[model samples]
Target: MGIAVTAPIILGLTLEHLEVGLALCFGAFWCSPSNVSGSLNHKMKGILLSALLIMVVSFFGGYLHYKTWLILPVLGFLTFGIAFISVYGFRASLISFSGLLALVLSFAHTSQELEIYQYALLIGVGGLWYLLLVVIWHYINPKAQTEEILAETFILTAKFLETRGQLVGQQTNREALQTKLLNLQSELVEHHATLRDILIQSRKSSGISYYKGKRLLVFVQLVEMLETAIANPVNYEKMDVLFKQHPGYINSFQDFIFEMAQQLRFIAEFGNDIKKLPKSKELSICFEKIKEEVGLLKTSEGKADYEDYLMLQNLLEYQEKQFNKIKKIKWLLGNPDMDAKDFIDRNESKRFIVSQDYNPKVLLRNLSFRSNIFKHSLRLAVTVMIGYVVGNFFAFQNPYWILLTIIVIMRPSYGLTKTRSKDRIIGTLIGGAIASGMVLLIQNPYIYGGLGVVSLIIAFSMVQRNYKASAAFITLSVVFIYAIIQPDITAVIQFRIIDTILGAALSFMSMLWLWPAWGFLEIGKNIETSVVANKDFLGKISHFYQHKGKVPTSYKLSRKTAFLETSNLNAAFQRMTQEPKSKQKHLDKIYELVELNHTFLSSLASLSSYIQFHPTTEASERFKMAITKIDDNLSQVITSLNGGKSQNMASTILQGDVFFKEQLAHEKLFLAQEDKHLERHDQEAHLVWEQLRWLYTISGSMLKLTSSIDFD
Candidate 1:
């Protein structure tokens, strides 16, 4: 609003009043969309760029400088360049829009042009105003982005726990939990994107971790298991038995889920009041159950157990590990360390939009998006073309109406198209009716300027508030503008209505003809490509680890590749989910796969980190050799996956304890060979080979696990 006022003022100061009006109208409407999605920095830069570009384009195009319809496309090309820099491909609506806006305004009451110098003066003033308003908005709410991030992150954590909780109980719905987990993972990605932005602005850590992440991942796995069970509910009794057999684990899971929900609620409030949760009663109960249930499974003379009882033992261990991680987090900045502020800086923080991928293609569809690109584009183009022709024919008598028709009709989203079309028609009609009444009721009017201000208010309010209310307000304002402009009331009102109807019809028809391009499909495919790249990186890591001790640059690249891949896929999915009709089975699967892939890779990374910290020694060389050999087999699995080959584990590998013992024998033999070889005065070389072999075997297996998750 300030920009609209100040732009004309600056122009009026530099040139003529008529020139100031054109400059104000052109610049104000040219870059009008509220840029709530972008940051303060982004909005500032984008508005400036948009203001400059529109000034240059509208200036050339406004004075009828081009006889041909080249101006719109040229404007589009410039907008695209701007979008490339700003990263707003879909929301920006480039060339088609430029023509649509300028033509409608020009065709309507003849628009006066600004002098080039006047336009330049207004441009600077308008840009500054835009910058000012955005700054003021931020000043009122500096931590808006941070709060949004924290809220989203907390929501996902609760969701993860809920899904996992169901998996633990006897009467739990497995299929629903699996779907819930996929949804949770999708939320996690969105949270991360938000976190990246907060990190960029305020270096706040989003408390995600190896254990919690893996828990969610494993939840999905359990859901997968449950889904299989759901398909055969006849085995309900058996499933219930499995649940009863692990009461300790089930109780712990419930406690974890409940605790997580409480934590999330706190975080979502964006408050630093960490909960002093009571000591988990689940732990005490679980200990009692373990003594009774598992004790029965163990033989009198040996540490033996029923298979389910053994599973219970493993489950307990997992619970403790999870709790420990949570405890560690509780110890660190659980109170939101204010001192951490001094450590944060703008440039050092990562931004939300920063990623390995950007979707630029206008014709791509998001995941599971059913809308066909070429067909949709063709349909829209034809409709828009029809609008253009119809608009031209009607413009001679009611040029303003003709342009409005086209602009009102060209909606990208079907629902939005419907709403906007109806609103434009109504607003125009109301404006016409108001114009007719005022011209008839009053003798003279100089109210157009005041009405223009009212129209601006209505436009801004309606855009963010309710669509219908906004349209109604705009209609009133437009009618007011027309009545105050001149005394020829009846003819002008009728003319205005006709022009609007024609413009509306042209817009509606053109959309039916020429197809608007999509930006989702290209993004989706690119996301798929990233996933492939991630798998390759993991495979390379596994294979390379088999040959070296220190992680090479190649391994770092692989880790970076994994991060990049997930980010790309997640972003594409986020866009898809934003559209209506996105909740479908295919989308669910894509999301699930994304979750699965992230979990597997993060685990491998975490596992690798663990290995780096803890090294082997001569005192435990025998066990080290055994573990290394086991890890080697995992490496073979990675190679198979990388080459797109089938994985066929020998049954012996699945023999568990027996197989492990046999591998230990091999490790001992290798260690003995190394010891003897080192004694020959080549100790350093032998030690180097030992370290390399350790890295190759252990790291290789971890990488293989990462790849297999993707390959499968």
Candidate 2:
């Protein structure tokens, strides 16, 4: 961005075409946000699309700026059209943002038709220049972004595991820990999505090279580690009950989990330099300590408490599996030439890369009051037009500044828009005050110019990471730039604050009144999707158990979908809480549903994880019945949520109870033996049966919960 902005300035100054240089800078600055991390093809496509849209919007905006009577309709049409493109997905949304920004900024400069064409062309050229620089940088360091995202994923995963460890300790607040886990899960889902796009798209475009393949393998390990962690779904209440009789066991497990987290953090810290990757910690000692505790419990309690002993053993085994996954990741990192085929098939790997639906029909389909994006687009257009009218009516110094604030602050959701509006206002006020003081104390244009450049760099870099800080730097950059060009710096600062507040007010009001799509109204769909994903995940686990072998790509994909949907549901619930209390319908019920859905996913993970690691007996009749009942319950829940009548399935419920009794009787026979030890297969089968029964019960609860919710 610095290069893209500065190079044009230098050329313009050298040629005494300062306006032309600034126009080019505007072009680059508007398009740079879309040049984010992705595969080369995606990066190129996003930037090129953004450049084209910006040029077109700029041309039209400039042509209509002085046509007073036509401003409202043209502005409304362009804003809606550009904003509506977000239906294509995240990358498209960024491009849409760039276009909308260009439309607003275009009104700031007046030009004849010829001058407009020249400015628009120069802006397009500037976008192309930025694109060129990005490509060069990509080639120079293709792996850097992927590595950085992967490193972040490792860190987030560590935090997630650490939180899970906290959940194990007796004195910790489980509610707080659960909330922390949810937040971490949400962050991991986002990072994982980005990493997936980078690694998977790169493989599709450039084919898998050694480094890409290795990174992909490491990513798979990280994902498996997450699933494995999720699979260690310790019933905290039960754990507490057991630990009351056997203290220090919980501490040992907690320490072991923390150790795993520490190992992951180490990997993240030194991931870029494989040679510096630290040696694997001796987790075996921790395992031995825990094992000794479990052995003592078994000896002291005898066969009467063998089930508890098995539970402890299962927990221990889960940790060991987690430890092995970390070890495997470390080995993969150290061994660069490791075969990618061992991880995922080249031909089948494309299934994991989620592609956006770029079909034009998607846009037309979303052009309804029912569509959230459509409502948001319409809201944005009206708000921007209102901002324009209010600015002109008030005769602000730069009416377009109001438009700029509107464009930047407004978002598709109320929570996001409100948060951005507040941050923009607060940051602008502080930034305006600081700039006011700086201009009063300093009189050098050179200082202003340098500071403007520095501020622009920081603002650009921090936009995604810290919006408040970015807004501050953006204010400073704009003020300093105008300070060099305009004499009345005080008015610029004053109007900046006023315009921002006005635009924010317009945005907030528009979101409130213009077909507002409250999160509660839409959260049901999220809940439905999450439940469906969990159902599919359960089916996958059932199939995996029936056919014991390597975890298929389909199973992994289902797991990913389940996790992602649950994360989305959690995010929606969070957004709903942030919305107006009056709009947050069924808040308590929704929270309960969200928690149940999350726990169900964890239960699925536990069942799947156990089957994946341990050797289990044949998929028994009782197990099949349990899985069927759970599947029926989930399907019924989905149906009920979709406004269809849910079948009671009383017969299936009765059969499941009967099967459970038979399985329990069979299990007791093994416990009655003097040896108090069952075959490994018998033990695994019993655990798997228990997991299925547990899932069936949860699914029944979810079904009842769904039926009780007043979705309307």
Candidate 3:
């Protein structure tokens, strides 16, 4: 981004065509945000589309600027049209933002030396030049992004594990821990999506070279590690009770989990440098301590406490599995030549990579009052037009600054727009004050220009990661740029602050009154989608258990869908919390639903992971019955949320509990025989039966909750 912005200024200075250079720089600056992580093909398409949109908007914006009567209608239409493009997906949203930015800036004719067409042409060239640089950088370090993202994934997973470890302590607030887990899961889901895009697309484009294959294997391990961690879900209440009698056992397990998290963080920190990679800690000692503690408990309590013993055993098994996953990741990192053919085939791999729907029908379908994006587009257009009118009424210099603030601060949701408005106001004020001090204290055009360039670079880099800081730098950059040309820098700074404040106030009000889409109004759909995904995931797990072969792509796809939908639900609930208390209808019920959905997914992960690893009995009739009941419950939950009459499953639930208890009792009889070495099938059946019973119980709870809530 720095290179893209500065190269134009340097060239313009050398040729004494500073306006032309700044025009190119403006084009590059607008396009730079779209230069995000993705496949080479995706990146190229986004950048190219952004460049085209910018050029088109620039030309029209300039052509329409002088027509006072047409300005309002054209501005409204252009804003709505540009914002509507976001219906396609994330990259499209960024491109749409770039286009809106260009449109607003088009009204500002800084160069009397160049024609509108010439300025547009220069900006387009700048965008293309940036694209060229991006391609070169991509080719030069193709794997760097993948590695860095993967490393971040490791760190997040570690935090997740660490949070889970906290649940082992009896003093911890289970609700708080669960909230933290949900938040971490959200972050991990995004990282996983990005990895799928990078790793899957890279393999497809370049074929599976050794390094790519190694990275793919490591990614696979990271994903499975997350599943393993999720699979280790415990009944914190049960754990707390157990802690009363076996505190040492619980503490041992907590320490072991923490140790695992530390190891993961170490790998994240040094995994890129093979020579500096830390050696895996020997956890066998920790494992022994846990085992010894459990052993003593078993000895003291005998078979009377077999259930508690089994819980500890299950915890140990999950810990061991997670440890092995970490080890496998380390090995894959060390041995780059390891075969990747055993992993998902190339064609099958593409199924996991989410592709954007570019069909025109998608856009048409969303162009309605019912569509959130449609409403957002309309709101944005009206708000931007209002900003323009206010700016003109006040006769503020650079009236487009108000439009720019509206464009940048307003979002699809009230919570986001409110937050961004606050950040923008704060950042603009601070940045303007500092810049004003600098301009007064120092009178060097050279230094101002240099500072502007540096500020622009930092602003661009921090836009996604730190919006407040990014806003500050952006203010500094803009002020410094104007300082170089305009003598009354103080006026420019004052107008910038006033424009931002006015824009933010207008944006906040617009979201509240302009056909607002409250989070509660949309959260039910998110919950329904998540439940449906979980239902599909359960079906896949049942099929996998019946077939018992290589994990199918369909199974993986269902798991991905479940994870993503759950993340969406979490995000929706968060947004709801940030809205007006009155608008946040049924906040408690919605939160409960979110928690239940997340727990259900985690439970599914546990069942899926166990079947994938340990031997299990064939999908028996009883297992099928349990799965059927669970599936029906989830389906009914969806039906209720969608405002349909759902069938009562009270009798089925009662029958399921009785049947499961009877089966568990029968299975335990075999294991209760101290002298008898139970066959492997009996042991497996015992574990699978336990998981089925737990899932059935949880599903019933979800059904009950949904039935009581008024989704409308």
**lDDT of the candidates, in the order given:** 0.48, 0.84, 0.85
RMSD of 1: 11.5
Better of 1 and 2 by TM-score: 2
lDDT of 1: 0.48
TM-score of each: 0.55, 0.95, 0.95
lDDT of 1 by residue, 431-505 (tens): 666555655665544455565566667666566456555655565665565566555556666666676666665
Q: Which stretches of candidate 3 lie over 4 Å from their true place?
A: 301-306, 341-344, 649-681
TM value for model 3: 0.95
TM-score, candidate 1, is: 0.55
Per-residue lDDT tens digits for candidate 2, residues 1-712, read: 8888988988989998877887888888889879876788999999999899898888887777555556888899999999999999889999999998899888787643248788889889878888898999889987789978888899999999888887774754778778788888898888888888888788778776778888888888888887777767778788778788777687888888888888888898887678887676467788788888887766655654676787788788788788888888889888866777567677777887787888889988998888999998989898888888888888889999999999898888899999999999998988898989999998999999899999999998898888888999999999998999899999899999999888888989888998899998899899999999999988898899888888888998999899999999999888898899999988888899899898889888887767776677787666777788788888888898888877755665666667767777877786566355533635675667677767777777777788888786
Count of backbone clashes for each model? 41, 0, 0
Ranking by lDDT: 3, 2, 1
Cα lDDT of candidate 2 equals: 0.84
